[model samples]
Target: MPLITLQNVDYGVGGPLLLDDAQLSIEAGERIALIGRNGAGKSTLLKLIAGELQPDDGEVRREGGVRVARLEQEVPQQAHGQVFDVVAGGLGELGAWLAEHHRLSHAQPLDEAALAAVHARIDQANGWDAQRWVEETLTRLELDGEAAFAGLSGGMKRRVLLARALVSRPDVLLLDEPTNHLDVPSIEWLEGFLKRWAAPGGATALVFVTHDRRFLRALATRIVEIDRGALSSWPGDWDNYLRRREERLHAEAQENARFDRLLAQEEVWIRQGIKARRTRDEGRVRRLKAMRAERAARREQVGNVRMAFADAEQSGRKVIEARAVGFAYPGQPQVVRDFSTVVMRGDRVGLIGANGSGKTTLLRLLLGELAPTSGEVRRGTQLQIAYFDQLRATLREDWNALENVAEGRDFVEVGGRQKHAIGYLQDFLFTPERARAPITRLSGGERNRLLLAKLFAQPSNLLVMDEPTNDLDVETLELLEDLLADYPGTLLLVSHDRDFLDRVVTSTLVMEGEGRVGEYVGGYSDWLRQAAPAAYGASSAARESAPREPAPKPAASPRRKLSYKDARELERLPARIEALEAEVAALTEQMSDPDFYQRGGDAVQAHGAQLARAQAELEAAYARWMELESQGS
Candidate 1:
């Protein structure tokens, strides 16, 4: 049986319908991805499935005794207790019982009956080990259980909420943008976790809304898209969904064209006037009116996000140059060091790393917002930089959307002319009514759109965007891709969206946690391939020389023909391998220390050389050991 079912659901009020006659059935162990344009009711449908919102006109049915847990985009403001207690709240009644039991235990003489009652409640809820489970889950998510919830950052708080939802281990999990505010490592962990949760033989089902295309491709077995108040289901992964959706749209267009032709013929018959009426064509007239009414009732498809940056003056050949740049806080170790890169005009560079790896710090240094502790930075005379902050900090909450876009000016210069602020906003798909609405009233995606509209209004030769893909809908994302592809300006981007990086970047700058940074030629996938374990054996120079298959190994000699010295060497190989591995690990750990980079260049180079030598020796020992084993020695 399906875990949750929504039959002919009709939602929303007097405004244009959000969901009309939408049907959805979520079966056990199904991993479904929900996608749609901004303001197209994806979140609303999740709420309905999670029982947070009821359908205005139809029935929502759930299997007997099933539980649904939902992780929303925003963390709850009231959950400001200790992190441990907040996550334990997922246990519901059992949490309350545990609390009461503790409270009564501390009272004088400890009421035995009260303790018994609490024990019974805990047993009934099957939550005797709930605290331990919550703590383990919190640790896995890299959250400190003992910390105060109010003291945590927004990202940390979101992680805690996610931990709570997972600790519950519900029959159905509904997640909305689970990857937002997460670092690359955290996203990878989440992907693995969800994959395990939806594995075969598991009763758990999932429905999530996300803009992370890689996440969709990894975990989604089916795609459910809400478009123009209608729901369509595609039974496959992201690539399959895209192919089928395109084919379906094309077929729909052809049918609409045929309907239009038939309507035109009916109009010609009606134009015959009195002669057609005298021929008793009343039935045909009624049929034509019905057809017109049907066509009028059909909803027009939603339009794509239209985005185009204003043309600006070209920048110099050298946009920005960094020479052995290093950055460190006062009396602290450097977060970025010896990073030298030349960014030229029209270079699309993507900066990527795990969280706290100084991606943003490097960007700030390049823009001259922060000075390097060591070395110098040079900027071209024509470099005019426009920055898009992920936080949308430039937007004013008190002002209306139109006012924010206009800043303090009465007009916005577009296409070499002064266009009215409202008219400019209309080009971005904002109606006059929506333009007059306060910024605080807009949804997250809408606010992101407004930020983009504001950023592109400025003319600049360099565009630096930090996590610009966050909170943007798919349509807007595609439009941003289109704009960036055609943009003539130098671009530097920091984002966790791998698919976006692959689509928009010509090269990638990777921050390997410590002060180490490496530049890769292509995109995110290219870096992954080069960083694979097998590829690690190949020196950086050799990998860059050209890609090729590994060479075949030589045939093994007979084990009985092995000499005494060879036998002794084979016995000692394991210890030698262990020592080399330990030494290499130590070198790697030292490299991750920011203080280690503060040493002079000679010492750093010596350490790197020694590490490389040890790795080479270890590889040779492994090869010999493998050859010996193949001979049954």
Candidate 2:
């Protein structure tokens, strides 16, 4: 049964319809992704489905006994109360109603029977256990046993709110950009959690609105796109949807082109002394009319967003180089140590590590925003670096988008160059009207896109971006990837987005703690295999650390022999081998899983380890078989 349904819904303002005659049916256990431009009514549609807002017209119906929960943006007043109390408040209204009903039922003086009934009802509803669930949920969210909620950071507080909503265990869950401020690790954890939460036959149906392509591709089984007040449906994952969308766009463009050609032909015929004989050649006219009708029915493709980095003067081969770089804030040990790396011209390097693992700090080192506690930070002669901080707070909130990109200063060449700021903004997909809207009104994703537009507008040979894809919509992200791929200058990017890194970067600079930067030959996937050997297997780790050994010839029986020693050693071998095999199998399964492909390095590494372990296991099995045969002989 459909958990919720929207019939011919219309949502709009004084200007135009934001969501037109849209119809949606959300099934039980369906994981739907809501996608659209910033002001395309994705959020507004979510509100309508959650019943927080009524449709401008038409009806929204929910299945009987279905419960919906939305992540509340405004923390309730009681949210400031005890953490336990705030979670309990989800059931507070129900509890109060039940208590009143019981009181009314007992017309006479309060009796023991009446009091027992009330207590029993409360226990059955699990109102008293709200604190327990709060603790468990918070623990899972990595906010367990915090000294106090008031002291928690904004990101932590958002986690608390998520916990409260999750503990309610609603039949339908509505999350709006749930990963807004979550670091890479936290987002990974949340992805795993949501998968379990919305597993087949699970009680929850998830409808998430997010610009995170990885998250959407991992979680969404169905994608609902809202565009210009109209809704369209796509079956399967985001990749599949994109493929189909592209095909549709191509067909539409061709059909429109054909119509345009026919129109031109007719105009030419009329100009060349042809009679107005359309009435006599009715069939031909009808065909032309049909073509025109079909052409009108098809909508034009929304042009891909443009991103052209300003041409900057070429720098020396080595742009930024750090030698034995280490940084530590006051009152703490070093956060990054021995971080040495060199970014060369035309190099596309991705910086990756756990959150607070110094990815940003490394970017800072390159930008000269922070001084290394030890070692040297050097930039080659004529090096030009442009940095994009993940947080867009540095942007102008009071001014419009165009003005923010303008930087309150007209384009002037520091070294014999001149251009207008408006011209630059246009290259980044800002229209005259859209660029005029205040930056404060822009959505997180829009603001991030705007920041990229502005940064790219300034000419620089080296681009140092920190979490550039954090809140960017998938469309914009893909466009950025295309731009970066074409860019001739140096690139240093810090992002947890696997797809972006794989598509744009040629090398990876890994900031593994202990003050060292691990420079790997390939992209993000290469870095992972080097980091976690356990992921491959125990033997693989041994082989990696030991000196390289040549492959034994197939006929070298002695080289392939298994040395059997104590019973304990023999007993452990088979079990260990089996465990390795199982690990390899699991990793293989994860890679094949559709969700894993949507994720970054984790899946690819898992897949690679699986292959490596399988090879080792085959070798081990062959040796074991040989030993058994020898013992039999």
Candidate 3:
């Protein structure tokens, strides 16, 4: 039976309909991904499924005794006290009982009945080990349990919320953009955890809304899209869903065109009046009226996202050059060390690392925002840089969308010509009505679109964007990808979206913690392939030079003689080689699993190290075996 079902749901807030007759059924162990354009009601549907919101019409049904946990896009405002307490509070009844039990245990005269009642409540809720589970979840999320919730950073607080949801282990998990504040490592870990939680025979069901293509590809077993006030479902991963959705849309467009032609003919017939006495066909008129109403009720299809970047002025051949650059904050350890690289004109470089791995610091160093403790940075004389900050800090809350984009200018320069601010806003799909709306009234994706529109209006030779993909809808993301592909400028990007990196960046700079940065020749997948242990082997020249030597001539004696140590070593070599080979094979198999790389951080590093050690040991064993065999050849 499906865990949750939505039947003919009609939901809205007295405005235009957001969801019209939408239907959905979520079953056990189904990892569903919800996708659509911004303001298309994806989050609203999730809220309905989570029981946080009621539909205006129709019924939302759930199986008996089912539980749901939701990770909202916005963190709760009232979460206080210790982090442990905040997370444990998600347990509901058991958490309250535990708190009461703790208080009663310390009373001046302890009440046995009160303690017994609390224990019974805990047992009934199956939360006897809730504390242990909370601790484990906190550790997995890399959060300190003893820390105060109020003292944590925004990102840290989001992680804590995630921990709480995970510890609850609800029957259905509904996540809305859970990857927004997560670093690459944390995202990978989340992927692995979700994969494991929803594996075959698992009871958990996952339904999440995300813009991360790779994450969707890794975890989604079914794809659900809300478009034009309707719901569509596909049983596949992201790639399959993409192909199917395209085909479906094409078919829909064709059908709509045919319907429009027939409707036009009907309208012409209705316009021509017939003599009522001779040819009175009231039924036909009524049918035509019904058709016209149906056509009018159909939602107007929105046009594709149109983005055009102004051509940037040509700069010198060398855009930026860094020589042995290093940086350290006051009274802190060095965060960037000896990072030397040359960024030539027209180069698209992607910077990637963990949360505190100095990606931003390195970017600042290159932009000359901060002076390096050592070495030098040289910028071309003609270089002009345009930056897109992730935080969207440049946007003014007090201004409307039009004012924000215009930045107090009536006419802005684009493509060497003056363009009206309202006209420019129209290019980004903002209507005049919406343009006048306050920035605070816009959704996250809309705000991101405003930022992008502002950024692309400027003409610069070098463009540096930090996490530009964050909070962007899928359609806008694709448009941005197309825009960047056609951009004729040097691009430097820091983003955690693997698919975006693969699509836009030609090369990558990986910041492996502790100030070590390595340059690679391709995208994220290319880097992963090149960095794998299997890719590490002797070069072609080394392989040719290390061919086995011809076997030595047999000794005169009937049996080959050897020292005691040599005989013992020969005896042990076969088993040792076998063991090492088995170990290498096991590690290789583990790495082949998609979840292996998604595990990230120490888990991946440990496996890589183990595989390397096993390979080395195997090589040594083979060498000894070759020597032993050559002695009696």
Candidate that scores best on TM-score: 1
**In lDDT terms, which candidate is top?**
1
Candidate 2: tens digits of C-alpha lDDT, residues 1-633 = 567888899887665677778887776556789898666788888899889899889999998898888885344554654344344345556535343433445446667776677667767776555545555665776664423567655556666777777766688899888876565555666777787788544446899887777677778867888876888777636776888778876896787788789877865654454356543466766766776676566544345566666678888988888888888888887877777777788999987766656777777777788988888899888877787887776687788987777767877232234556666566555667778887777776678878887787778988878778766667777888898898788888887775677788999877656656678866655555445523222234223533333555577345344445533455566776776777766654553343443343333344444565585786787577556655431
Candidate 3's TM-score = 0.79
Query: Where does candidate 2 have its weakest 10-residue lDDT segment?
Result: 533-542
Which wins on TM-score, candidate 1 or candidate 2?
1
Residue runs of model 2 more than 4 Å from their true location after superposition: 14-16, 72-126, 139-142, 150-158, 258-299, 407-424, 514-517, 533-633
Which is superior by lDDT, 1 or 3?
A: 1
How many clashes in each structure?
0, 3, 0
Give each model a TM-score: 0.80, 0.72, 0.79
lDDT of 1 by residue, 155-224 (tens): 6777789888888878999999999987665676678778788753357888999999888887886688
TM-score of 1: 0.80
lDDT of 2 at 189: 65
Give candidate 1 regions above 4 Å deviation.
Answer: 96-127, 139-143, 150-155, 408-411, 415-419, 532-633
After best superposition, candidate 1 residue 556: deviation in angstroms? 12
Q: Model 1 residue 46 lDDT?
A: 91
Candidate 3 lDDT score at position 523: 74
